[model samples]
Target: MTRCALQAGALYESTSITYTPECLDRLRKAFPGDFDDVDEAMRSFDPASAPAEMLSVLRSFTPARAALPGAAAYFHAKALEAIAALSMRPGPAAPKARREDRELVEQAEAVMSARLSERLTAESIAGELFVSRSRLCEAFRRVRGSGVAETLRKERMDAACRLLSAGGAHIADVARAVGYARSSSFDEAFRREFGCFPAQWRQDAV
Candidate 1:
């Protein structure tokens, strides 16, 4: 099987193993830093050998695996490398920034940060940066791989998340603070962006 297929299979299998509270805690803590190590540890784990609670938890966490027919073993190795590297520390050398695009991206990021409460349209940002809307869109897409509206939405959501995590802000207050005039609109947007309602997000964050 290809590396991605193998990794996906491994993830699927590991997710099926019931983890103890201690094991789950360790896995969660280590996952951010060393997913490969966690995967390695889970390789030999058996759900039948685990406590009932752990097995119960595994039932919810485990994903169903699909067969990767016609996948090559070489591709599996490459996928493993990709997955492992995704969780590893950066190597000694950082990649050089693209100076022109970097400058524009920085400017766009700054504008988004500064005007979190403003109804920032792509045209307005393009005008402020002295570029045509299409050029601005291209620059943003080249640098961020997303359009201006998506970036703005991300920034607004980020701001909202921060405010929600602070623990005293009402949903409506946060909605207004992040530029949505109507609370219902903000709630809908928040749900679409984050897959959860603002109140649920706040509770979960807390």
Candidate 2:
């Protein structure tokens, strides 16, 4: 029973629990090869690891057993149920980036800061570093927990607010300086992001 349990657990870990040499040998004595492989595949299988064909085979196994009606059917059903449950449960999450990836992210952020007024895109940044956009986005999200566009918008807004509070530059100038092409666009973006117009924000800051 302990051996069965351990073998069952091992089978559960796999996407498809195909017959081991021992299990195959035992099944062969009672059943033909037609169902032996299918039986092994259905029991203690990990749905993820099992091919679609294996799942279909497993599903058919119970009905096939009903045709003959044996101990194999009982064991097969129990193992199949266990494997199905395992498959339904979520898999382990991916591990996060290491410290080296974090450092690369910081370097990317510095690049962003230096080009605040320039139109920056994730692809452009990733291209500059010879990395894929997905990898860059993943690293940035790991460290900052925000997308590249959102981070850039926040930085631009922060700069705009600082300029507004300083009260030396005209709103239009501040907007242009912070990468906004027009005052109206800047005002709209500011309101959308900061919940107030740039002038209103300036007044509140005062």
Candidate 3:
């Protein structure tokens, strides 16, 4: 989402950002030492440490209600969303997502695959993809025949099962590996998903 490239359409945004040298010079003057190593700052921005409150605040600047009638509101709303996202990276631009395919389901799947370990929610994932939470879920349901939460849970549980089968990692470790915050929560989900606890499944597999 931070790529900040302005793509025009209903949800109009491309994940790309550009900074001109003139802009850089102005910023350097404003922030001085901070801009000296802008690229380094951007590269070092940790995803885990993304300022949740700050990002939320920046994103909130976008107009909540699409006040404009018809297509104009789409542009107004999403253009601001892109602008807000551009401010996220402390410096370097996020690599732009390819323009060829804007398929939400495919993009969502790719995102899910890449960040299995990190804590994720459908809303946060949607925010990262520059789409509304409802839009994201609808896209999943339409194309994948499942909800986003269901897909994510399945992926996490599948990873957890593989870890359990391997037999070296403890259940707590497995839980964290699959994005659960605690073993208890993981146990509940594991049982729900498989109709058996993780340990029992592993033992039975053995």
Provide the overall lDDT of each model, using Cα atoms, as 2-decimal numbers: 0.60, 0.61, 0.62
By TM-score, rank the candidates, best first.
Answer: 1, 2, 3
Best by lDDT: 3
Q: Residue by residue across 104-184, what tens digits does model 3's lDDT show?
A: 878887887888877776767889999987677656645655556667877888888788888988889998787766677
Kindly list the per-residue Cα lDDT of model 2 for residues 30-103, writing each as its tens digit. 32111222332334445446445445655554444656757576657656454333323322343476796788
Native-to-model Cα distance after best TM-score fit, residue 32 in candidate 3, in Å = 42
Screening candidate 1 with a backbone cut-off below 3 angstroms (N, C-alpha, C), the clashing residue pairs are 2-76, 3-75, 3-76
Which residue runs does candidate 3 get wrong by more than 4 Å? 1-102
Q: lDDT ranking from best to worst?
A: 3, 2, 1
Looking at model 2, residue 197 earns an lDDT score of 96
